[model samples]
Target: MTSLPEDSPPQMSEDDRDTAVQRLQEAYAEGLISHEEFDERLHQVLTAEARSELVSALASLPEKHPGTTSTIGAAGGRIQRHGVWRVPRFLKVESAFGRVRLDLSRAIIEHPVIDIELQLGTGRAEITVPRDAVVDVEGLRTGWKDLRYNAPRRSGPGEPKIQISGTMGFGRLKIRHARR
Candidate 1:
């Protein structure tokens, strides 16, 4: 077996580091730092091990901007949101005899708390999120109640608080992690 450093966190993506470097370059070009300072910061950004480390390295940069309300619908079809995307504050989902997949593992969540109103009628719905997110589904008005809960849902800092509400009928609503 192999052992890693006790202080070392999870490895971050190279693209994340590259983006940090680009931000540093932009800041330097904007005269935010001198050449010598930029070089030093660039070294630190390139060597960051964890995502948190890289985020701290670029804390001075602007955060991801918020998105407006978005409504995604599917009628006898499929609707999916995966990869990198801007999650709006309010999301209205409609699916009738269709499939709806909302993957938020790598999504840019602008608001800490998100409101989702689902109108699923005789359709399947799947919500994929990061492992740390909290999902609430008690507001769903459905008679078909076959539930599976892997972990308890709670809200806190750095945790996406998603509130699910509205009408659901003759369909399955599954909430799970992206890794699973």
Candidate 2:
């Protein structure tokens, strides 16, 4: 067999290809790419032979905002997030007399570690994390109610770790791992 050139582009792995596909899907959902463009780019990402080819397919997509925190607050209404929405690295959620439910089973969480700070008053908050996630509630403080969470038997290597903190007033905070 012939040796490859030194200047050749690096070969794309399955994980790289999967990440490229997820980027294209996110761009399409955000209306950054039209149907035709999404289809074309998706084909390119799937068939990409090198990392450069995959990069070209994902070119022009805006990078995630660094050092920016996403906040969701409700005074008396419910707050919910599920499906394939993007999950930022830092998230702050506040609800006063409102129920908060966050389902991150199918979320696009690019960060290996996510920090969620919650401030709630008199309303229950439920968070369903990814199955492989390792949750840390050490910084969470509760008044008049206990946090309900059963730690997993074991967390796998390289799985995302979610750090939840902040205060809860007169309302229970429940955390559960999503089922496979």
Candidate 3:
């Protein structure tokens, strides 16, 4: 079989094309891309006749953070992270029984959004976020005690959004914004 010209677009495998489509979907779902942008990128991916075209479709999208998750666990005691610390993109906190406290008031948060996943068997968990931060706990599932968080009347622009998710078997979760 005769090969095409050197400048011709290289062929893309089905798996590669599917991966590009999935990436575009994720970017749209994460609010990284607008509906119109997703549609455009998706169209480019679907109709791309070459590898370079597929790459262009996903060129500006950010890759998923790898090894950016930090897990903190306690079997039956107190677990706490306070004071000045560097927070990861994703944090998983697990405690079997006892109190857990995470103070992000003075922590270094470099991301626009961070996720804190809590899996507690019993006891209370308290989280203190930055004064300008917004918290979203809609993904959290609790057994008895409901989450306690008093949202501000309005949030300022450019503040980070903290997403707290996962299951809590028992005990209360109190989230408060920093005073200073």
Candidate 4:
């Protein structure tokens, strides 16, 4: 990993190029990428196209180790769960500018109440709730024109409803709430 200043723009150094090649090799070995395709893509990564693609791919990769809090938005982004361990629960998610991923499939709420408030400058946001959870949406403004919203089906819900209300902007917002 090439250690660059946090504020530095996304540019690949010699070390970064080597790291990308290494990852590509690992991916090929893991069957995620074919040897031939990996060689072709590796060439591309060493060229100009690698700049944006590599940065985006790296950004989307999940954190390797757990319990490692990211300082990217350590002060502004948080997930607060308030209630007892019952069939129903209340979850409030608040973010100034960042992306959020929620999995309600593993949740054991009899009744689920969700409230979301997002102030996204140029970030992405996502929310996933049980299909039985009621959904309410509002207040979305985007700085750019490429805003996206995806609402899928519910996976599992013993007996819970979901409610959502919020405003969004030029970013993205996805909600998979219950069908109430």
Highest lDDT among the candidates is held by which one? Answer: 3
For candidate 1, the lDDT comes to: 0.72
For model 3, the superposed segments whose C-alpha errors exceed 4 Å read 1-63
Compared with the true structure, all predictions reach lDDT values of: 0.72, 0.84, 0.86, 0.48
> Between 2 and 4, whose lDDT is larger?
2
Q: Per-residue lDDT for 69 in model 3?
A: 85
Q: For model 3, where is the 10-residue window of minimal lDDT?
A: 1-10
Could you say which candidate leads in TM-score?
A: 3
- Candidate 1 off by > 4 Å: 1-67, 152-156
* Ranking 1 against 3 by lDDT, winner: 3
Query: For model 1, how does the per-residue alpha-carbon lDDT over 29-90 read when each residue is reduced to its tens digit?
Result: 44567899788778888777777777666666543334545899877789899999988877
* Number of clashing residue pairs, candidate 4: 20
Worst 10 residues of 2 by lDDT: 1-10
As for TM-score, the candidate ahead, 2 or 4, is 2
lDDT by residue for model 3 (1-180), tens: 111234634677787787688668657756889999999989999998887788888888887667888999989989999999999978999999999999999999998888899999899999999998989999799998998999987788989899898999989999999998
Instruction: Identify the superior model by lDDT, candidate 1 or candidate 4.
Output: 1
Could you give me the TM-score of model 3 versus the true structure?
0.70
Tens-place lDDT digits, model 2, residues 1-180: 111233644876787777678667656655678999999989988887878778777777777455657999989889999999999878999888889999999999987778799999888999999998999999799999999999999989988889898999999999999998
Candidate 4: where are CA atoms >4 Å away? 1-90, 138-159, 177-180
